[model samples]
Target: MGTTQLESVPEPKYWHLKTVLSEALDSEFSVGEILPNERELAARFGVARATLRQALEQLELEGRLQRRRGVGTTVAPPRMGVAVGTEQRVWPGVGEDAWQAVGCTLAAPPAAVAAALETPREQSVHIVRRSRVSHGQPVAAELLYVPQTSAPELSAIDASSEAARARVVLRELHRLELQGQDSAVELGSARADDARQLDRLPGAPVLVVTTRYFAEGRTAALSVATYRADTCRLTFGASGVEILHGQERQAS
Candidate 1:
């Protein structure tokens, strides 16, 4: 007599596909290696295009992969630590790190930014927007303010010239005797603009890092940086490195 056998159900398509693709990225793929187009991957997996895209979106959000407009999805490297305050408050480029100034603008600050800047609601501040990209993937976006004093020398600079503008800001900031700094990290969602710059949808989860640079006992400069939380683990002070390995969240 032939025995009837119970068939095992295939894993839920999205979860199974994401799991398979994630493991593949960790194993076969090296950081920055571009993957086959999503269409091709979907075909290979025998799943609908939506299902494939869902999985890809998850990977990108988790920083396991990155997707660009003209370019395709590529494996993402680890997030940069960027040494918050190791020895002393050094000026930019003092170390091997490089910070590229994306663009600069003058506008009314957000409520939080205004509060941090200790400026009036009607007062306009020069909001310099900067982005840090490492290993070909965008990592952090920073908003810096000169407060008219931190960069008093900037008036001598030709703002139209990118290098001139960047130099003016850096030159003035470096003049500060490198005093102390205070930083705070809190749960945040990418605002409309941040999400756009970070290449994610509105309301995407992010770690907002606000740091205040003090020199001569006064607030010298202030920076509000947003880091992709899914792909980043924000560390603070001397204890952060030890805390990074505390515990990994278990999959529900």
Candidate 2:
């Protein structure tokens, strides 16, 4: 009989480091506690700075750690559960919505948004910028596209300023009878503008949520909102008690 050779299995350094760091976070660290400097951590772990950084990035994505550009890394608190689905279908800005209008502009939306809104490519739409803040931290940035036909009541006077137009666009949208709404969520990287508003680096992890508003048997508006994947737990259903772990979902 021929001798059988055992195959060697090698684990990725960063992945292994991430596992070790995760345990440490659970037993050794507290929320908001500052961690050791990257240089010291890398040396202590006997790993390259790049490897350590990769592990740290993974931790941050899992909401286990929080990293700032100027400030050092710190333990992150539990992700906030943000309700995405509700029992009743209602237009945004109708109830006590969490979004706050930032600005508005008349411009041609992206090709995808135009297609979703069923609008002509050449026609400009009302682009309303909004931001969501939770626990005093900016969590999401959104761009709501409202076609001219959907919000025909808006006037030139309303477009004179960004703030005024934002309110007008939302107000006009409320006039229409909202028949239904739908949303889809996926993982994505933050765009430059969105990253700036979210106070994160460009290309950071984000949960892209695309929502469509229906009125008069047609798509009235389309909203693209990007939430910080590191710090938000997008919730659904009637009861808001359900919580999701970001790392487990990401791994799947």
Candidate 3:
């Protein structure tokens, strides 16, 4: 790294340093390369250690750097592309292999989800938990809400375990004639549960994709998937496959 003293600018010093560090990452660093320690970097940039720390945090938030446990800060790989929506609309878990069923339970969903599902706020629904992994790293977590009215045939004898219940809920969803689906994406902070599933800190940046499945002329199910922002990039397209970090690959 060069000892390029930054000139005074209107932006905060840490912000300016973050921009410079980002450029250095692009030109001088490779993915997974550990950056110099705080003392060395602060001296190199002629900035206070506090300023350097702030800049590093910013870079990490922007998905440019990663601070591994017991390993120093390193350049993060390009975000893996996660297919949020494709032309062929299918129910969650139908023809999908990327996500694994975690568990399922009956509970009252959040108010927003209840509103979206057009269910009574006090009504309990089947909440299915799922996780998605890429490159052997957890990348996303999901909660699929199914109203009782939507899966009237689910029985306790058929779904003996939590995972089994999740599968049965999905099976019931598949029985519905999937009329159409719509999705919306936005930046969000990871909640405690999602952070644990994705192996990220609470309040870490995340991309939230909310999808609504329409069937029988009503909102039958709702899916809210939270993806790790630092490791996943979302894509929407006609082809079922989505681009990987920097290359085209089949969605898994």
Identify the leading candidate in terms of lDDT.
3
RMSD of 1: 7.6
What are the clash counts of all predictions, listed in order?
0, 0, 1
Model 1 residue runs over 4 Å out of place are 1-17, 26-54, 77-81, 85-87, 91-97, 101-104, 129-140, 149-160, 176-179, 185-208, 216-218, 226-252
For each candidate, what TM-score against the reference? Answer: 0.62, 0.86, 0.88
Clashing pairs in 2: none
TM-score for model 1?
0.62
lDDT (Cα atoms) of all candidates against the true structure = 0.66, 0.81, 0.85
96-146 per-residue lDDT for model 2 (tens digits): 777889899888998888889888888899899998886578899899999
- Which residue pairs in candidate 3 collide? 98-252
Ranking by lDDT: 3, 2, 1
lDDT for each residue of candidate 3 in 1-252, tens digit (9 for 90 to 100): 676657667788899999889999999999999999999999988999999999998888788987765787889998788776688887888774668899999999999999999888998999999987776888888999999888997634266788888998898888989999899999999898988788777777889998899999999999898988887878876756343766767544
Model 1, span 70-130: residue lDDT tens: 6777787675454344445655534544456776655577777667767676666666667
Q: Give candidate 1's error at residue 72 in angstroms.
A: 3.3
